[model samples]
Target: MAVHRALAGICLLGLLLCLSSSPAARAASKPDYLILTLMWPGSYCASTQLTEKCCKPTNGEPAADFLVQALETYDSTTGKPVTGCSRSCDFKILPLVNMLDDLYTYYANLTCPSNSGMPHWKDVWCTYGTCSSLNQSLYFDRALRLREKVKPLVNLGSSGIIPHATKSYSLEDINDALVPRIGFSFTVVCTRNYILWPFFYDDYLSQIRVCVSSDGRSIIGCPNGRESNCGDTVKFPPVSYPVSSTVIELPSGDEMAL
Candidate 1:
């Protein structure tokens, strides 16, 4: 019994040490808002001179796996007990996975040949199932026919607006559609050593990148460009060229291949 108690104490101490050993650990020590940036289907992917893997469309299993891993990491690090990371009340990933899964199935069904002896999906009797009949040159044309079906997954849902409580505001409250000018915090998380957060804001503005999620409708970090003193809203998602082509220097005196 004494030996078992000592072993349990040692295990607990090891767990505590692991939780306090690094900046990432420290950042995860408390519950903070995690910014989840899903890679859009159209977004550029990393590539190498010898490999043209960049810009390739994600497959059915890979995308889902990536999302799951991201959510698990965020949950484990944040110490926040949440069921999942979807757009629902808790902003967990389950809903997003379900959305993408449905899309993948739809796309796969559309890829099937019409005369494959398989029953056609309801109301989908058009030229969709005949993708196999088209030539390579006509592939793009056929794919465009499915564009409307795939568009919703590409858009980032709105993060919504922060109201003054007394002021009347105009605009549909949706993510990516528009965010109001209000107090917010810009959070950046680097998953890999070389990854950098892509955002732009002037230091002169009254903005702070607090380590916690904005509780209300306040801007997550900074207001829109219309409120800029220079009068030109700073374009965000600050230019990302190929990381391999451009060089970036890390704060730790390490040069990145970017």
Candidate 2:
């Protein structure tokens, strides 16, 4: 009987040790801030056929130039060479899920935050928060964590929420959010007009961007202005089917102010 008891105790100790040493055991339960800002029509691309200094939509400026300039924040420690980015006119292309996943992983692993020593536009800038902020990687990490947690929660491949290549994921397809803190606040531009969108079937222009709260609990639209319900609460179910693209704007002339 005493030997049996000792054997049971040893098994229990081993179990505890295994759990404590696992990554899931030490994983972050919640972080202070989480953010994700998605660009629209995917992002801009420059004309490959043009060599002239000036060109219209057919051979115009790239969109990445405008996006990088507007956001002014990126991972300073790590960056990749960006090409065909301008303001005049550019291609708006959406990357496949695999490509996007690579980017997210790379950003999450960066160690430095300084903008100096960067190559060309590869330098990362800070917008709402500084690059040297504590757990800057938290934002990126959280995105990864969320993706893992939400993967089994829903069916992303055939559910029609995002590209089929996305097997396991979390957060909206527009932006990836991960952080170490519990709560935070900041503003980001909404590049796409999901509520009032154009190019309904196009792959690049389908998503939109909006300010996200730090906790990853809720999201509100329309940050600025004096309307009573400026950032009112709204909800959208999982994209399980095809839906109409046009929005009702204002329900056939209501008395509400524009």
Best by lDDT: 2
Q: Candidate 2: lDDT of 105?
A: 23
Each candidate's TM vs. the true structure?
0.24, 0.26
In Å, residue 142's CA in model 2 sits off its true spot by 2.8
Each candidate: RMSD: 19.0, 23.4
Q: Which segments of candidate 1 are over 4 A away from where they belong?
A: 1-28, 40-43, 46-52, 55-219, 222-258
Candidate achieving the largest TM-score: 2
lDDT of 1 by residue, 23-79 (tens): 455333332332222222111222112332333112332231111111111222433
In order, the Cα lDDT scores of the candidates are: 0.25, 0.27
Tens digits of per-residue lDDT for model 2, 124-222: 222222221323234333433433333321332334433322232233331223111211222222212233344331122222222233443344232
Candidate 2 similarity to native, TM-score: 0.26
Cα distance off (Å), candidate 1, residue 74: 7.4
